[model samples]
Target: MALTDDVTSCLIDNNKLFKDIIYTAQYTATSANHLGYNDSSKHNSSSNSSNSSNSKPLPPCFDLKDAYRTQAFATTTVPHDIENPSVKRIQRRLVDKFLLTMRSFISSLLSLPILALLVSVAIYKTTVLHLQSSGDQRHHSMDEKKEALDELLSQDETYYIRRWGYACDTHQVLTPDGYILKMHRIYKKGPPEPSQGAKDTKKKPPVLLGHGLFQCSGAFVLNEEKSLAFMLVDAGYDVWVGNNRSIAGFGHISLSHKDHEYWNWGLKELGVYDFCSMVDHVKVHSQVDKVAYIGHSQGNAQAFVALSLCPEIADSLSCFIALAPAVYAGELVKNFPLSLLIGLNDWFYTLLFGNGCFLPIMSVAQQIIGPKIFCFMAYSMFSYLFNWWDHHWLRRRKAKYFQFTPRPVSVRLISDWISGWGRQGVLLYVQSPPPPPPPQQQQDGYRATSMTTTTVSSMPLPLSAVGSKRKLPLVVFYGTADYLVDGQKFVEKVQTCNPFPMLDLVHVERLEGYEHMDTIWGHDNHITTYPIILDQLSKVSYP
Candidate 1:
């Protein structure tokens, strides 16, 4: 009873009326136990005490049980059978408490597994997305490598042979030093009926085509669409493409036994000896006092060299067209890769290439990978950096031409052009000034000094001093976005030479989006830049 009172008081304080009623029921059960109400203890001492306490003598315990039974019977017999309000309230409270306990237990049981499943799904999705992005980047890199290789191999070859279609014969020009140079004569037909015999019967002057370093005369003629030779031929000029020594057509020339070392000569020797020989040969063969000269890249370098050393060549040049001229090699230093490449060990390259030519290895690589790989490689290395869409425009405007090669040239020749020029050669010319001799001692002694000096300063005269009274008219064109040549510096170098006043200060202009090779090979060159040169050429008159 005391425990009941305590429980009841705690529940009442908390305002839990249903809990108080349950505690009261528990107290009643405890009281019954204390009274010895087991079935076996029918006439127990507790029962006797209850009987003695009664006022009337108890007949028997059975009689008392009978009396109680009679009372329960009477109560059952009553008409209205109403349930107790406390009992109903207690039952409703029990049901609610059971439900609350069941809900809490069920929620606790489900929470752990549900949380684990959500975490797993999130991790899986993140992993899958990362893998997909990596795969895409790899695929893109591979595709680019494939495309670059193809373009290199797809260049035109037939164009070179086409320019030689009118060749009377191919002859080897032997040098005094025993080096042999190859020469091809392209015959010309008489001009278009001389405009119905209008008195003047002078024959048209022959136009000579000169290719650049690491390239042969074929380079000029190979691209039919953008071939310089083709353009001149179309313009009614007798086109003759000159292959420099050590290139595809001219590589086999036999050097004089006295100067077997001459084959080691780079552009320095090419300018002094090779170009001069070609010009003299062309003049004799064409029977013309002067010829129109068009030189591209390295060819332009040779032209300047020949004119500087042999100023009389200026008289032989009626007009000159320099395409992507490469007179001052210093201008190319602005290109990062080009500078690195030029600065590399020339001898190491010679050892790897053996003969110093690259085309053979490039050709082999192209054949192994196929055209698609070549194109992809080209696009990846060159496109994004140089904005090749503009280059595509330049190439599209020109005729498509193929390149042909008999075999690879020696890498030594290329090394000479890249390393021997500009840095090494220019420094030598600047540092070691040639000794000044009496005017009488200049002529014969000058030739002797030029022949004997192994250093750069003692080498042949600068190409800028082509004619006695006039410097060769220098015109330079480059792309502003070009990754190869510095267009601005190139223009400035020409201005330093102080060209003719009638000649513009500098002819340097940049193609919007052209690269190193794209100046000539690009599709838009024909439309955007070629016309400018053609217009200038049209105004030039031969004496």
Candidate 2:
């Protein structure tokens, strides 16, 4: 891209400038030394003549008095000693001045590249942004595909969510801490079915989908009809997508957007309050005692955090499905430049996104790559993170990527992982008693006495109770290539840190060719991934 080329040119310019500076410095140092030598020799001749009693007179042809027709030129003057420490100090001062001048010049020149990098990034972003806003595409030979894309250029989240046959509802969920989250639910539309026999009509359990980093709930419906949201509805489950504080919509009921409190939340707050509150709301609305949970990447990590805090979540929840669950990464996608890129990327993110939300699609980034070329930009930009070198796979999946990702995500949640500043791994699962469940409803239409409101796990840090032998049923769908989903490392950590046995890891043995994002939105997800998820859910006994 123009941005990349400009950066390359700036780097070359910096190198050339450095070489020139070195040459100039060498020349300046040499010239100063020659001048110092001539001055010192003159001082030495004058000083020796004044100090010696037997003075050596000059030859008649070279006499200064004969040439000037005057008396002795140096009478009564204190002749300077070139060998004195004072004279040497003066010479060193001259050389130091020359060196300082050269260093300052080189420093000023080197600084230009920093400005150039910023300018290039700005100009490239500006030019692309202008084209996207122009919307004057008559020069494209009147292609229908171009027109279709032009129409889709202005669609928002609600528009995309309703594209499939599923109905979308945005519910305002108020957390305990006053954060009002807009949770989107997708359910099949028709007259209400039987609440009758299991053999005659087996009603599906309520399922909630959690979006990964920098993405909204639209990730589920992005694959058109084949997305996980639609597939779950077709398979007879009530589907709801929970949007964390990272998205653009959620905020506090009392705290205004202008208030600093609106932006003062993190991933820990999300796990502690947002998810549990949403789960409570869903159970109340759907009349289901237990729910099924599915999450991708950061979604999976936060959910595990919630589970670790409350181990009874396994009983309150039927089963958990983690799609390329982002436990941790030893490195970002096993390679050299890829490793370097991850470190630099984290640095850039911290430099760019200091606080608040990161809106890549809606902000200046949209101008640089534009709405139409979103998929191309995403595929090319993130191709380094995946094992996506095969020409065929890249060609097949390039067009669909934009629909699923590059949405607004919380800076606090995403920066820790994306910026690569720290190892943003999941919390440890500890051996402790399961947190008590919510109070049961009495048969006389009265609520039973509730236990203590707060539930906190007291397990010691760094795997202190591995001998306690407690476990929760989990199903993981991961790929061989995703660095985030290290199969061996994940199993070992769970076994060593928690009471769970590593050998019992429920892996998707059937589906092979899947990567991190492919678990939820792959084109053939209904055929390959749905069966695995459904098989795990089917094992749960529905009331």
User: Which candidate leads in lDDT?
Assistant: 2
* Root-mean-square deviation per candidate: 48.9, 29.1
TM per candidate: 0.51, 0.58
Each model's C-alpha lDDT?
0.43, 0.50
lDDT of 1 by residue, 129-218 (tens): 445654443312432243222233344343244433423335444322223455554443344444546443544567776775545655
Name the TM-score of candidate 2: 0.58
Error of 1 at 221 (Å): 3.1
Best by the TM-score measure = 2
Q: Candidate 1 deviates by what RMSD?
A: 48.9
